[model samples]
Target: MQFLEDPVLWIAEWLREVLLGWGASELVTNMTLNFLGAFVVGAMIMVIFILLTWIERKAAARFQDRIGPNRVGPFGLIQPIADAVKMLTKEDTRPKGADVVGYVLAPIVSVFSVLMTWAVVPFTQKWIGADLSVGVMYVAAAGSFGIVAVLLAGWSSNNKYSLIGAFRGVAQLISYEVPLFLSLLVPVFLARSMGVNDIITSQTAVLFAIPWLNIPIRGFFVLAAPLSVVIYFISSLAEVGRAPFDLIEAESELVAGYHVEYSGMKFGLFQAAEFLHSFTFAALMALMFFGGWQGPWVGTNNLTGWLLGGFYFMLKTFFFYMMVMWSRLTFPRIRIDQMMNLNWKFMVPVSLVLLMGMPLIDYGLRGQELWLKYLVLFLFNLIVGLIAFAWAARADRRVKTHTRVRFEGRPVAVMPQAPAAAEDETAG
Candidate 1:
């Protein structure tokens, strides 16, 4: 029964024994297993990336009231495969004066960084790539590689538009990380652990506790730290360059952004990286704020249970991924200035207060019932969120009023007319 529940572990153990029986060294056996595990993970991510392309296109088509990809295959299921073939066969090109090394490496690094983050994601209670004590920090570090990739692509392309896009991307990503990092700390604070798995484990306990009614309801961190989740979600959008925060590829301004000079499969790599990065953050949100691999009928002891737990985790992740797609389809992309103001002015302050204030609340409620602690935390989130929103609203109104007053007396400018040619005397 145990083997059936975790067949990978079972097969690995069986392989280990076989190698031992053949006098294989322990180090060699361990290395072999690790390599196989990594290969499986990498393959799985690539397969999912293919599916995401189809899904995003179909969803976008529906959003725009048009049929998408139906001609390519059944409901366009084969569209991604066809697209991949086209990308593979396209002529590879690089502009003159481009740095060969950075140009060649940039796309590879972009995709690799997204793949690296999956190392810490827990699919089921027992199925995780690595359960490092500092998994949170590792994820942060791995994700930072995308910044390097963007800079490399831009600087090596030798294009003014690509350089501008790369500069904007770095600024947006680095600025938003402040809020994103702070929001991440809220879960770390609540779980009192920096490990990803530990955070998920901590959520397995009481989800919600109502002291007034003496009723204990299941709860997730989202209920306790609603504001943190909001900040995390928004900041993550910018981090991944998703719209309406997708300033990285503001085509109207940058004509395809940092990857403008890339072609063939190299450009495909950038596309794959963007899609995967969005899904990765969605999965992270599920793990941190939702009860990852935790739901009714999810058995930790059996294979069926493990499979079901993975299903639930993916379901949660897909929900958020759809939310990202929905936002992309529904909202117009904001300007660069507005995006910066949102991160530096709003998300940063709210996240800082949440991060610093959460520990203090937990301290004051020391030795108290878990439910009481969560209740106070929930109320605290609400108060902070309300105050932040109110302040933002007031600031917005003030800016609007000031702009209206300043422009009220200004004269409307007329379009300049071109000089007319003199009438020909011969024609007269």
Candidate 2:
């Protein structure tokens, strides 16, 4: 009956007992368990990656008003499996002058980099894969591997288009990473810890309070640092190469981008890496901004609480994942110049402002009441937000005027009108 409390640990304990009885060393048993846990988490992510394909397709279909993949299986449930088979059976090709080593290793590195990020994601208080003191830095380092993968794919492909796409990807990713890292600092500063679990624990109090009415909401970071959340999400979308930040993969421009020369399972791996990476960042967003697994009926002190916490974590992550999909399906892809301008001219500056402003606010408001602290912070954010919006509006107006003038100045050919419309009416 105790197994019902925390089935995962209970099963592990049972396995330990069995292994010990069989004379296995304690170190070996522990190693076995850790390996199994890592394997399980990795397998789960891969399975979810398959499901994401169907989910995104169906969501896009709904947005476009069409029935998607109904012919494959019940509600198209087996479509991903079918697609997997196609990828497996498809012909694999390599360009004649391609660098075989990097070409083959590129997709593997891309997928591995995405997989490593999950190692630090805290699913629940007890269910985390790792609780490193520098978990936040670990995630950042792991993500940088993706840049290497993109470069390899582009340079190794021996195609000029692939090289160009890779260069653009590198530029976009590196540019957006500035704001992403800066936005991440807000949560770390607020929580005063780098561990994901600590960050989640710090959010246990109410985020906002109306003291007079005695109304309060749970202390999710989103409510406290919405500008940080916005910056984080937008920057993450660019990092994932999702639209309108998808200029790296702009088919009209680069003809399939960095992976253009990849075929068969190699291409499939790149696609899988992308889907998983998007979901990973969404999970990170949920963990950082939405309180990870903290919600009603979720208790971390008890073993049974882990199960409930897992449910809440997945729910929050799915919500954010759907938001990512929505953005991809709804927005048109922007030009490379436009994308760069948005990052350098807007996102980077705003994130730097937020990163600088948060620490000052926290320092000044130290030891203050929660309500007063959040209130002051909120007011400060509002002021900065209003100013930023005004600047953006003015810039947009200027660009529009310039564009209109440039287009209006182009020569136009006038069509000749009928010579005698009035006389033709009587003649007819």
lDDT of 2 at 404: 97
> Which stretches of model 2 miss by more than 4 angstroms?
207-216, 301-304, 399-428
The reply for model 1, stretches above 4 Å from the true place, is 21-23, 207-216, 406-428
Candidate 1's displacement at residue 116, Å, is 0.8
Give TM-scores for every candidate, taking all chains together and pairing residue i with residue i.
Answer: 0.93, 0.91
Residue 219 deviation, candidate 2, in Å? Answer: 1.1
lDDT of 1: 0.89
lDDT of 1 by residue, 130-242 (tens): 99889888889998999999999999999999999899999988998888888988888888898998998898777464778765565678878999999999888889998
Error of 2 at 260 (Å): 0.6
Top-scoring candidate (TM-score):
1
The whole-model lDDT of each prediction reads 0.89, 0.90
Candidate 2 lDDT over residue span 55-156, tens digit each: 988998998999888988899999999999999999999998999999999999999999999999988878889998888899999999999999999999
